[model samples]
Target: MCHAHFEDKYLCRNNRISNIAVPTLKMRSPLTPPSTTSLQQLNLGHGPSPSSLTATMQEAALPSTSETNVHLNLGEKTTVKKAKSRVFLTNTEKYLQDKLVAASIKLSKMKNRFKKLSVNVKAAKQIASNPAVCDILENCTSTRKLLISMQCQEDHKKEKERRFTLQEKIASLSIFKQSPKGYRFLRFFLFCLLSKH
Candidate 1:
């Protein structure tokens, strides 16, 4: 019975070793014939170093802090520029306000002058329309009208003398023609001495 038990244990151990050895043999079979090119390609002497590849991956994964800082600085500069422009605009607005105030003052003065001129014109029109004022002006200017009438009479007398001279010349020419008799005959006899014809 001891021999029978020892034989069973030997068979179990053999089965376990075969099971373990089969996978180990399969796993070792591919590695046992080492391809020198494949080994050299994986080793440090043939390909890019692991340190440079890790650094490239790390740089790709991280965000750029300097680009964000530049954007922040640009934003601050724009804000400062805007503040300066606002100050300039405020100063210009104050200047315009002062100019507007001065212009308004001048406009008010012009309005007052127009009011005075309008009042004076209204008073003059009113006085001219009043019959009492008209009579007063006419009475005060009687001597001036008398002088104007005297000058008009002198002009009329000069016109009458020129007309009389023209009539006399016309009568002398008609007497020389002697081809008439009635009112013209009486006018010729009164103005001309008859010659025998």
Candidate 2:
């Protein structure tokens, strides 16, 4: 494994154990062979060293103590007791102000949405009240076009008829006014009609 991977695993392993030691080998030059002098100095039972023998014997004779375990446990516990901190520790006044601002914004958005919905409802009511407005509100392009064209044609015919009748009445009045005999006749006819009434 890579150095980072090895350390991550080692740290995780150390977190679980109360007291453990993992020995790692130090890197040495590849060209150098094992040095007998170094091994001999450490007194690895190869050559007789009286002082090293006594030191090794003394360590083996002693009992395992609770002091080492206590020290190791304390060292590992520091990371757990490092005073838990909160991410957001705002004062009461500041928190209340933030909540009020948020509520106001939410209220504004809801009011806007309600206004839009009311406007749509009002428009739908208006469309429903009048048949022509309802017909105009149809989504189909061809149907609306056809209805508008027919209405226009009917209006044009009515306008033409009204104009024709108005023109006929005007022509008859002009002719009657041009001749004195026709004017006298019209006066006699009006007098008779008024007398009957």
Candidate 3:
């Protein structure tokens, strides 16, 4: 849709060099109905009761699979209660699982190798489901521990360097007042100075 603005040219990001990034946009997607009012317009402090809000949400939500139940006996009507499934993975583990899968994909496709894009459980499952992707991602889990160990090592090295640089920069860094906007040029990147020389 932004073709008019871009003039059919791809988006470009500049660092030391220019990199063209082609963005993927899903078209003809269903749009949600307009909201009755904005959050700022409502009295959030005492707008609605928690139970009432929950009930409203449930009413608005689509019917779930659990709501549909099969009954063998037509003569007698009965209700069956289903127990909630237990969650085995914690929030952090679930997060890392997704990241792990994405990373593996991007790494696979590097020079003479598949550039692994992601390393996560969901991505891994998707890749495993595809015979073609599986052919490419044969050693996903076998290298998981290795990838994690390498990540930890890199983090440790960066942290040690940062601390050492910060100690050295403290004596040299001079404090100066900033602009009228109250933002100034950062003397150090996250308190660790990088030498230009």
Which has the greatest TM-score? 1
Backbone clashes in model 2, listed as residue pairs: none
Give per-residue CA lDDT, model 1, range 33-139, as digits (tens).
77888786777676777888999999999869998899999999999999888754488889998999999999999999999979978997997899997776688
**Candidate 2 — what's its lDDT?**
0.56
Number of the top lDDT candidate: 1
Tens-digit lDDT track of model 2 for 1-197: 23432333355443542233342435344587669988776776566688877888998886567877887789778755664542455698779988999999999999999999799789868867998876665765653444344343343344334222343345445546688576557435431111111
What TM-score number comes out for model 2? 0.22
Candidate numbers, best TM-score first, in rank order: 1, 2, 3
lDDT by residue for model 3 (40-125), tens: 35645558867888998997785655554323442234322222344479899999999999888766656333233344455857
User: Which is the winner by lDDT between candidate 1 and candidate 2?
Assistant: 1
lDDT of 3 at 65: 53
Clashes of each: 0, 0, 29
Instruction: Give the C-alpha miss distance for residue 191 in model 3, angstroms.
Output: 47
TM-score of 1: 0.24
Estimated TM-score for each candidate = 0.24, 0.22, 0.14
What are the lDDT figures for the candidates, one per model?
A: 0.59, 0.56, 0.47
Report lDDT (Cα) of residue 68, candidate 3. Answer: 43
Error of 2 at 187 (Å): 71
C-alpha root-mean-square deviation, each candidate: 27.2, 30.2, 44.4
